[model samples]
Target: MIRFGPAGNGNSFYEAGHKSSLEIPEYLADVGLNAYEYQCGRGVNVKGEFCRQLAAKAREYKIFLSLHAPYFINLGTSDPKVMESSLRHIAKSLAAAKDMEATRIVVHPGSVGKNSRSEALARAERLLAQTAAELMPSFPGISLCLETMGKINQLGTLDEVIGLCKLDKCFMPTIDFGHLHARDLGAIKGRDEFEEVLDRIASSLGAEVVQNLHVHFSAIEFARGGEIRHRTFAEREYGPDFEPLAAIIARDRLTPVIISESAGAQTEDALAMKELVQRYQTGEGGRDV
Candidate 1:
């Protein structure tokens, strides 16, 4: 089954009177979501006991779990100190994900910095390969998901992410559609564009990878530099609606984990996406849900 949920607990989660992250699994289950991506973007400070508790709760609630690693991890960094820190961060993240029984952990490939895109990508590729060599055997159950970044200066375009995924069978691409849309200055207007993305991934990585994809979707605002901010679905002015993608997903019978990162209203937006996908699955494809 295709999974739909928020990247983290949204405002309504708190408004519903839940005070702890441990409560999120039950809360998500109650709200009709079947997946959750735990945020560790700042740092991996979660205790093993807490992760064990969360894991149990998630299993009981039938919620699939994923983790987002630190935002500061820079695999392309020239500095030895920075590269060491990046490896440590990935190690800690994998450890935490293992404790949580998370199937995958998402990572950013880092910025281009002063180097040309090719040079930066090469550096990131080598470092990621090295990191995988050291870490993959220890965390056999967890997949490392490299994300498509939002900024043009970043090392994670769709092609870049796909290349990284090819470095290891255990690696996967976290295709963030909103990031692609923003980075291209709203190039993904509808189904044709979305289908092109899917086609490219399928052609490059084969059917299994495309069918069981890891995805991030959101409405976003952008400037020339790329993603300005994530916007709620209610913000109708944002480009790249989810309906087109939902239709394709249903049509292809793909079972991807689609996480919403729509500002503070992610849960509601995720629910909307779920409904949209269901409608398409039921053969009710149209502009209207």
Candidate 2:
């Protein structure tokens, strides 16, 4: 279906006279978008009944729903107390996802902290496996998406997330292209570069998952540390250009759910990417959305 949508209540969304997150799906459907990502990046603060009604509204509008879990979860922690806290945080997010009937819950796979990268990753792996074993039975329908972090010190690399996905049946890779690009110092450019990523995922996980990917796209500013911030579409010169990825998506006829993470213009940028894909598929050139 090649779904294109925004990360949260987009910049334009607030201007359109909306206050509640639950009001997003109908607006998205009205604008030809078929997907919605509700952000609980701080934490899941709502009641189960609230999420249930939100899920029902999304289903009524045929919008695919996904949730971004809390930002504080760091399963790579060396401290036993912090690890226990992380477990509780993730479990709470999973419970919310089950109540909301969300297809996926995006999570940052944790950081290296004071430990060596290898040690942190190994810790993360064990924690994730334990999490799956404990929670999968209760929340079987939702997938835990380990995100590709933009920072170098963080545990989430493309390979790291892919490895984590292999740790459990409940996990999947959340392919944050902006984070990948930033981590590689703005590496992605043309079709070959973009296809190399898709190929790696396909080779590792299988083609079906690759074809129906959950991808994030945005132009990012990066330093030696990686991922300074996400930029708007108006900053065209700064990019791992969407056109190349759009071309590949169209050519391969993949059914990816692409979420835009532009600082404020996420919905506008997502619509722009959807337009770019349409232009490529139709073989027309140079039209903006």
Candidate 3:
């Protein structure tokens, strides 16, 4: 629903003991943010009655919920045990998300170790397909989104992720604009390029998918291939260009949940993006003015 949000708990401004994931939805609600992505990066630490309470609270506040699976996952691993473990984690994360009434779960496609890129991608696809089949019955409403990875060593690419989404309707692509920019070493030059990426996604998965996009954005540093680390929006020199992205979202009437991943300044950046989107929607800038 064109939701703008931060990656983790929005209460980073609060003291450590004063904040918890359960308190985030209400805080975000108070701050005018309608969406939140629960970060289970280390593990899905929130469980049982706590999860159910959080779900109820999120519903009470009308906060749109999503989850990021643990960073330790590697579905493309050559070892079957590793793959199985990844699957189990995904299944558990999905259950947690279900309890929290989360709509989607974002996952990394895993690294390309000794295998060739294509081979790794195929392996990831098979593993994800199998995982989806197993989870479909239980988490019927949750969509599993494979995110585009920034580094060259990782299996995810825009095309590769789109291909996986095409394989199954339940699967979708979470386009990380910072990662795309880093992956290409700042190739997304302007509005047209941004539009083209969205066009490609629409072409691959149909226009309806654009209506509920799961997106991540920030300024990033990259070396040879792409993505070294995230930077604050103000700190970025070379970029994935937010203005053009804002323009595209305006022109296309796209409704995406944009999660800001700016290092240590996520809430501030998210608010800035929301303001930009609102301005774009209302035609406040020179071209429209």
Candidate 4:
């Protein structure tokens, strides 16, 4: 199925009088979503009991759980101290996912600081290879999902992510269409652009990978440096509209897990995408662009 969810509990979740993360699954199920990405952008400090309880609740509601690893992890770093810290962060993330019975952990590949893009990518590749060798065997069921980044100087371009994923079978690409659009200065104008992206990934990673891809989508504000912030679907000024993507997924029968990263309306935006997909499937959606 094409799963739709928010990257984390959005403002609506809290405003609705739901406080605990444990209630997320039921809330999502109630709103017609089937996935949830727990945020660990700061650190992976969730207790074992909490993880287990959340997992149980998710299972009860049939939610597909995922975790976003700490944003501080920088696999592209050349410094031994930073690299070691990054490795530790990922190991902790994997442990948390295992405890929660989450199948995937999304990661940012890190930025290209003073080094050239190629050098940064190479460093990231080596570090990730080490990660796969040392940590992956313990978490056999979980996939390390590398995300496409928004900044122009980041190490997560579409090609870079695909190349990194090629390093190990357990690696998957988290195709953030918003990031791609922002990084490319709002290049994704319509269905044709989205189709090209899907086709590129399928050609490089095989049809199976593309069919069941991990996706992050939201409208974004961008500048020359890329990705100012994620915007809600109601922000009609944003260029990367979800309707074209929904139509593409419907027409191709892709079963990606789409997570919304809208600033505060992530849950609402995710539901909107899900509704679009349903409409497209029933031939009631707007004309494909």
Candidate 5:
């Protein structure tokens, strides 16, 4: 089923807090959010017995779990040692995810650094393919989701991520609406464009992928290339129409997990999005441009 929730802790209920990531699930449960993403942006904080305990608690509450690996990883590094280190980091996260019973692990596709985009993408593909080949047999239950990055210099794009997913069934793309909006400089103006994106994903990876979609939504600011920084949903003025997105989600009956990344207002924004989706589904709201 579709799971709508905030990006981080639902319990702590604030954006910037020093609470341990393990406590997030219980807080999410109390807040009526059915999913939580463990952020390992710095590193994997939960491990050993604690990881298992968190997983069990999540299962008890019927809260789905996912993970975001360390941001320092660069899968497209030109140096062999750097590439190997990146692979090791991903493997570490995967092990933690398996222990925690997380359904997916979101990864940032590496940067172009000094190389050309094509060169970076090619290197990234090789590293990812090798990593997948090595771990697929052991981590059969976990899916590696390559996120569509907001920055132009990053290796991720809708086409780039989808192309990489073609190499392995265990890999998929995490469609971040905010990232897409930033990438196009606020181009997602209407329902048709939003629907077209969904259609493109289905055509590329088949419709089943839509059922278990892992998504992130927020208001974003962009410049010449794409993505300057993230802003609260209310702060954005140009556009990334959530109303049209809600309508599409209801019409297609897609079971997506939408994680709100709206600065520190994630919980409040998530609730608003959930309410909007419900209204659209029940035919209580009219479509707004």
Candidate 6:
């Protein structure tokens, strides 16, 4: 199914009188959303039994669960010690995802740092290969998704991420449309632009990925450095609006799980997206612009 949910609880969630992560799935279902990305951006600090409990609840509500790997992982590092540590972080994140029965873990494809992009990516490729080789057989249900980087100096160009995906059949690309827009100075604004991205992805990966991708969407503020921050949907000037992307997905009949990463009100924004797409699919009109 085409799932939609938030990266984490936002201000509105607490404002709505919700207090626990355990309650997230039921709340999301009540609100008509069906996806959730557990934020382990800081660390996979939750206990295994706790993750299993969450997974069970998620299954009960039919909410698709995913995880964000810790932000500190840097397989691009040349320093042997740092590379080792980064691999450990990925391994731990994978283990945590397995415990939660989450299907995928989104990871930043490392950074440029002091090295050239090519050098960093080459090193990252080697390490990621090692990671998959060691981890995949044991955790066949889990996938490591390489995210498209927003910053000019970062290691996640669409091509770079696609290339990294080639390291293993298990790899998936976390195509963050907001990041793509920010990086290109708001390049995607309509169906054609969004279609070009889909076309490229389908060409590179295959029709299956085109139809069943994992995506992240939000409006964003940026500078020459790219991706300054995520913005709520209410922010008028900042965007790669959900409307065109929604239209394209509806027309293509894809089943991508879309996660919202708005600065605040992520659940609200995600619900808005889900509703808009639903309308488009059902041939209802006058909701999107």
Clashes of each: 0, 0, 0, 0, 1, 0
Better of 1 and 3 by TM-score: 1
Off by over 4 Å in 2: 285-289
lDDT string for model 3 (1-289, tens) is: 6898889853364744446678877787877788888889998777678889888988998888899999888977889898888998898899888888888999998999998888888888898789767776688888999999899898788998999888777899999989988888887888777878898998889898877788998888898978899887778585776888887788778899999888877888888899888888988833431
Weakest ten-residue segment in model 3 by summed lDDT: 9-18
Residues 1-289, model 4: lDDT tens digits: 8899999999999999999999999999998899999999999989989999999999999999999999999989888998999999999999999989999999999989899889999999999999989999999989999999999999999999999999999999999999999999999998999999899899998999999999999999999999999898889899698888889889989999999999899999999999999999999998854
* Pairs of residues clashing in candidate 4: none
Among all windows of 10 consecutive residues in model 4, the one with the lowest summed lDDT is 280-289
TM-score of model number 1: 0.98
**Residue-level lDDT tens digits of model 2 in 54-158:** 899898888888999889899898989988888888888888878888989999988899899999999998899889888767887888888999999888889
Model 4: how far is 265 from its true place, Å? Answer: 0.2
lDDT of each: 0.92, 0.87, 0.84, 0.94, 0.82, 0.88
TM-score between candidate 6 and the true structure: 0.97
* Per-residue C-alpha lDDT of model 1 across residues 263-289, encoded as one tens digit per residue: 999999999999999999988878642
Best candidate, lDDT-wise?
4
What stretches of model 1 exceed 4 Å from their correct place? 287-289
lDDT of 5 by residue, 1-289 (tens): 7787777654336444637666666677676778777788787767668779889888988888888888978977798898877888898899899888987999998888899998988999898889888976689889999999988888888899899888889898899878888887777887987888788889999999876788888888888789987777778583576888888788778789888877777777777788888897888868753
Model 6: per-residue Cα lDDT over 76-110, one tens digit each: 88989988878877888888889889989999988
Cα deviation of 243 in candidate 2 (Å)?
0.6
Q: How would you order the candidates by lDDT, starting with the best?
A: 4, 1, 6, 2, 3, 5
Collision pairs in model 5: 11-27
Off by over 4 Å in 5: 10-18, 236-238
Clashing residue pairs for model 1: none
Residue-level lDDT for 160 in candidate 6 = 89
